[model samples]
Target chain A: MDELMEVLRRALPKVNWETDQALVDDGIIDSMDVVSVISEITDEYDIEIPSEEMEPENFNSVQAIYEMIQRLTEE
Target chain B: MQSIVEAVAAHARALPEKFCIADSRRELSYRGYWECISGYAAHLRDLGVGVGDRVVVRNGQNLDTVTAGLAIQLLGAVFVPVEKNAADTRILEIIEAVEACCYIAAKPMELSCPWEKLGDVLSFRDESADFETFPYPGGADTAEILFTTGTTGKSKGIELTHRNVVAVAENVIDGVEMKKDNVEVIPVPLSHSHGLRRYYGNMLNGSSVIILDGVIFYKKLFERMETFHATAMDLVPTALSALFRLSGDRLGDYRDQLEYVQLGSAPIPQQDREHLCRLLPNTRLYNFYGTTESGCSCILDFNAMKDKKNCIGRPTCNAHFIFTDEEGQKIEATEERPGFLACAGDMNMKGYYQSPQLNAETIRNGYIQTKDLSYMGEDGLIYMLGRQDDVIVTGGSKVAPDEIEDAAMQFPGIADCGCIPVDHPLLGKEPKLFVSMERGAAFDPAAIFQFLKDRLEAYKVPKQIEQMDEIPRTYNGKLQRKKLLELEAARAAERSES
Candidate 1:
């Protein structure tokens, strides 16, 4: 989860990841952005972000993204 | 001579039973349409409306607004249609600018200065025999005053004469091959040129017209089209984008019945066009380019889609175009140089209502100088390059935001994006990119920045990327760059406070 937060901080430094819930709702990370981030996470952690796992809830925050990555890689 | 009343009368004489207009409430035949128009004309005459007078029409997309527009023309009064329940400021501005003799509201309500509810103002108690007859006003008489979007600044009332309106309708019919059997479903706002022209074009040919109030109801719109067996339809790019995103099965069903689709107001993206073609192979797609000042400048047919997707095609019949540089010197069609587009034709409006300064700036000699930038292709087709006002100047080099936005939309995970010029003390003005992503997508700012860096010049790449839920849009669905700038400014202020 800390690794995911670090990655998000590098990607979007302007956003206050702690309080700004708009990361997803405000269309900041659009579909293409999500796809790009999934690929980046896959490349970084050597874990694939499957199409089925792509959901808004799974990408709500840095912690969620990290946990999802861990679960996919472990499986 | 080219008044809408005369046009309707001729059609009524030939095909009284033909479908003229189909609204949410009712469908009126040719004879019924003429009778209603005559009834409304008599009501206007009773209110002392005559040639050179203006009648403000405040109504949603209903049968009343259509008939009221025809009636205004029949009575030789300029029809000034403001959107129903518009802001008091906008309504007052329109009423005052046009010097409207009487304002007609769709619902029953008293308004300031000679305003009356349409229902109360016009009597519909079968007074057909007692209705007064209004003769058609000759050409050169003002027919309507349509307010421009005012995106550049203040909204200006564009005065379109009877000849101008009729000529545009004729040109559009000729260009698109609109027939009497054609049923045009209009989904744009009645206050804008797209809706008004589509309605009038069908009426001119005695073709059927269907009016849909709210355009966001795509499912309902598709159902209504199927129920009515509509042949043709007019829409803006935003509506087309929504329709493009629908499931293939649903799109297939609608495509099977549709004859042709027309898009205007903004340029339709190439991806949307290809998607539409794949879904509706038989239906012809046309992109119409025009402004409130110059009605319909050009019509890009489906065939032109092959060579260049963004080409707005050539000028319609009875219209001539010229490309002028910043120094106002005419430039020939070339690969590198793009210039401001100007047009001279019968479809062009007389001038802005009561604004000589705006009139002088826009209309010169015989041409209406369109502020849009475009370059002509070898095929003689015009390719629009974003608006001149929206051009971003950074480090003495001019960059169009559309090119950057277009490139960004192609990038994976980027749902939509807009580029705006942010104030930079050193560079004077720098480009800033604001992007929106689809739900559930993870975004990497570094990856996006790198992707854009590879695709665009160093200066063109946004110095900062701001993620947004949705890009702000104008009422017509065009990108609201000015509002986006405001959003960026507000964010900067918040950051400074912190």
Candidate 2:
């Protein structure tokens, strides 16, 4: 979970991954940021996030992203 | 000359039953579009939106926003469309700049200007009502005020007269050969001059435009295009990057169906241009170079000008260029000597609103000096060396970031790259490269620099390299080099503290 937080931090350094609950909702993170996160996680975790899985819900918060990653890895 | 507003009304009368615009929810025929425009105009007029009044509009690229724009124009009021999600400070700045008479948004927001929620504005509209009439505005009247922060750091409102708007649209029509049947899919914001002008060009030709906001649902967007039988698109380079990343070879699949694709807001790299040319050989791919100041000036057809580099093509039929030195003396850069690019035409802007000093410096004899280091080749096509402010002065020689980034884009496993200037202790300003790796591609500084060394001149080679999660770009997909420089500045400060 900390590792996922690190990846999120690296993707958008200006963003506060810890406390910012509505990352996507608040417009702190945009479509481009999501793309970067996808790329970074794919490179780090070696898991391919399919197009269908690239939803706003999966990336709105750190915990959501962590959960999504776990689901993909488990699969 | 028929103004853009008049053209819309004409299209309504001439092609009443033909398709006009479609958002996510519904589609409107030319007649239906006109009816809606008229309906909204009458309502706004009642709400005290008078002729020549400036109206701050929220542009979400929905049917209401687009319809209301025409309504504002119809009333002889100036339409000031801005991004929906723009910061409150920025919106306040614009309102104060124009002394805006009213602000129209998607929802009710407490504003300095007279506030009217778009839904409430449209509630009084009766679809069954007769056509509302107003005096069509003259060609010289200010129709739209587009705000841009380019050229100077501060925001400046660029006034586009009805004549200039018509000429800008016509230039695209002639350059891209837009037909009546072509349905252009516009995901870009309408507040932007590029997207708005593309809309005008389509409307002028009696075509259709579909508003798709972003690449969040781009796979569905591709499917929507297929559903609409979309034959045209006005896209930026970053959107192309996102789409390519999300779905490989999807756009290429629409080569036959799409008649033309107009690319603008930023210069495309040579390899990507050539790759697109090969992919969409039949599709007329136009890489246009223009600004809010000089509307849609240069357009290069990749299918025609294959294997070209740094070429922004020739000035459109309406525009004529004069390259000059720092002192603004006209010098035709027919080959090697790149000069400052200036353009003069009906398509050019009137002048920056209330900015006399900038107007004097930029606009001369109807020619607006574009701050780009450009040269007209012996082939008569204009080629950009770089933006004048962005040219890196390393040692004695000058290097354009476009050259570095374009070369790096061809480097193996590189998805995106930005070449930015960093403060060098000796050289004064030095080139540094920041890259984002492609899928499954890891950052390898040694291999990358080695590849760049062979391709670039020794001086042009970046002194330092770093991996960016993604290269930062404007919403329109132009490389935000200034942002990258700021990032470098912050890094330097951190280094000093540590």
Question: Which candidate should be chosen as best, given DockQ against the real structure?
Answer: 2
Candidate 1 C-alpha lDDT tens digits along B1-498: 386668888887788888887765467778887777787777778878888888888755667777788788878888989875366678888887777788887443344558666644225422352223566788899989998767668988889998999888876787678977998888777888888887778777778889876443455566668767899989888767755553334666767677788888875555666667777788878878888788777888763376674467877886889988876668884546678888999999888888889788887778888777888888778887667888888988778888788777777778778899988898889888888987677677788889889988998988788898888877667788888888878988999999
Please tell me which predicted candidate would have the highest TM-score against the true structure: 2
Q: Is the docking of candidate 2 incorrect, acceptable, medium or high quality?
A: incorrect
Model 1: DockQ vs. true structure: 0.02
Error of 1 at B482 (Å): 2.1
Question: What value does the TM-score of chain B take for model 1?
Answer: 0.90
Write down the lDDT of every candidate, Cα atoms only: 0.75, 0.81
TM-score of each predicted structure versus truth: 0.79, 0.86
Report the lDDT of model 1 for residue B80: 89
lDDT of 2 by residue, A18-51 (tens): 8977765544565656778988999999999987
In model 2 chain B, the worst 10-residue window by lDDT is B123-132
Off by over 4 Å in 1: A1-75, B108-110, B119-132, B243-249, B269-271, B302-309, B393-398, B422-430, B450-463, B486-498
